[model samples]
Target: MKLHCEVEVVSRHLPTLGLRNRGKGARAVVSLCQPRPPARGEQAGPHSACLLVSTMKDKRGTRYEQLKENIEQFFTKFVDEGKATVRLKEPPVDICLSKANSGSLKGFLSAMRLAHRGCDINTSLSTLTPVKTSEFEKFKTKMVITCKKEYPLGKNFPYSLEHLQTSYCGLIRVDMRMLCLKNLVKLDLSHNHIKKLPATIGDLIQLQELDLSDNHLESFSVAFCQSTLQKSLRRLDLSKNKIKALPVQFCQLQELTDLKIDDNDLIQLPFKIGQLKNLRFLSAARNKLPVLPSEFKNLSLEYLDLFGNTFEQPKALPVIKLQVPLSLLELSARTILFNRIPYAFHIIPFHLCQDLDTAKTCVCGRFCLKSFIQGTATMNLHSVAHTVVLVDNMGGTEAPITSYFCSLVCYINSSDMFK
Candidate 1:
């Protein structure tokens, strides 16, 4: 269930900051981590255990076979009617069947079999992709390739290994087995039926940006997660996928500057997201998140898009205190009274306050760090997700109500938040 992103145009036009994808084609043998999920049987040695795992993988691929059967059924109907047309889902997967002769049907069947790599998933991945091997090889020397727009125009461009844009090709699966484009800097494989990304993509260690938006991918593979190729990635777009949670290995990308995971089924962000200190932009709109970690304040985000989420207002604040005590934020909360701070944020107030209104109640004992207000601790407030849940789960004992402030002026004059 990948969701469309709120702000995508910014990065598309942002010039690459001089980090070129220069690499020596030192190819590494890429392999998929065998998808593991069975309990090792008792009395089996590591060797026998490996064999059993192999057998399980072979059986696990039956779903792909089922999909192929469904498609074949669609073809059966088309062939009988001699309609020279095929539709996969009642409509919309219509294939012209290319003139309906027995040879044409056989050719179409061959193409269908090649396209359906479901029997062996990786066999159809970004590598060994039989879809456009000739096209990829024809302009092997060019720096960038834009296929979707090019294919319809019937035009060809010089291929540069630096960038590849293959949008709306109606590609289901591709084999990247022969792909070793060393200088590849960015790859846009958006809006396709691709459910899996080949680990071979990691071979492009110089690749700095990757856009995998609007694909059916549930999650990235473990092999790709562990790959060193991710180290060079400064911006990654994984919008509109079925991903529910990020892999723990995601913390490896310490240099990431931009990340967009909007419109997904994410309930919560990875606990290690704070590790991406270089991040300047984050868009997680339209998710199921209940709350963001307090560690979020640590990031120096330039642009943040969090609308359409389950996020409530940020924790209420009577006065905000500067953690590093910078000269800018050290105005004693009095100097900036009625003036705006640099940043605005939101948070959920599920269990802390009896009333969720920001102006009336200090739900999180915090407030907009952006609103300019005086520093004073007179007003009352409560921790939004903390104190209440703590009291309820902590033996349901009555706990003392505590009040904290980010600004005294903001606390007393909280109505400005509505502005």
Candidate 2:
């Protein structure tokens, strides 16, 4: 078949028009027709180029406008979430509060009268007004209010009326017994003379971690034992408290890997402690524990800090296998405490063979040296006639003898031998 061809000029402004080798800011001849000479006197190539450029510009402009609109919508959704303005303070600073979506904003602020520095919302007016934080005794700012109706403004701490004083009108005393820190993740009342945690503390369903160390807490319970966050809890620092016993329900925290109960008054651990299958690190150091539970044998625990406890059963710790990959086993038995090794290759029972197969495999391996004991049995000489047994590979492939080969021996034992 005969073909026709024609060369046409394509402008730089319409770069998408399939023009080839068009120099910067100039036009080049792009073919419009194939395999035939242009019709006589029909050299209208440049005229056709101008029409294509106008059409390409319209298409490109519409695409650019659509992309710009999508970017603007993305920012609008994020801004509505209050993501740009809400800020949370770090440690040694006030905890940031998230806006409440419940009830009236005023009712929420009235409830959180302990937040001494943050803005208080007025639900009736739908406006947030700045709060007047009162300076209490000893130069410590009252940033958090707990136990409402119990700790009233300027009641426990004598604040002067001359300087900036906290609002006492909306401020109700925090009831320590009915303590509710709902929606509160991190609470820091450390170094304070506070006495107790509210019983309603179990309501904090979203709490993932807790730090109640260095307090005068004498006893606590498992009211939050069934909380969904129980399994999600990974870290717990209850050191320096006056706790006397470990709760059995605490074993339900299967995901807890780090637990610190140092400097407590715990006497013994509940058997349920063994149920913590994921426990990797535990510190009961400086406590009054006389003996660890036999249940500790089932734990896959790797690190245990029992530095100051009286290891009552140190000699009887055989029930617990030290099979954890990297364990730092501390054995503090009364005045006989060991911080370093006395000899190399101590051959402790914890270092014994882990399983039967591994022990048998090692015994049959090439590293065999000398056996201290040897034995052989003739077993009544097997009666009237003399019997001889021949053992060989029997022309079969010789890879290695293993547990898998024992199946043939098992099969023969199940079948009749002389029938």
Ten residues in a row with the worst lDDT in model 2? 60-69
- lDDT by residue for model 2 over 1-419, one digit each (tens)? 00011112223335466656442211111111112234798642211210011012121110011111111111112222111111112111111122122222223223223122222222212111111122112222223444435445454331101111222223222233222323334444443333455546655444556666766777666655545657567767778878898656667777787788989888877645766887777777777766554345456655665566543422211122222232233111101122222322244343331111111111111111111111111111112112212112232111111111112233234222212
Question: Which regions of candidate 2 fall more than 4 Å away from where they truly are?
Answer: 1-101, 105-181, 193-195, 226-229, 314-419
Write the residue-wise lDDT of candidate 1 on 154-201 in tens digits. Answer: 433322346777777765654362144444678777777788878766
The C-alpha TM-scores of every prediction are 0.40, 0.37
Query: Which prediction has the highest TM-score against the true structure?
Result: 1
Global Cα lDDT for candidate 2: 0.36
Model-by-model lDDT, in order?
0.45, 0.36
The whole-model C-alpha lDDT of candidate 1 against the native structure comes to: 0.45
The deviation in Å at residue 49 for candidate 2 is 56
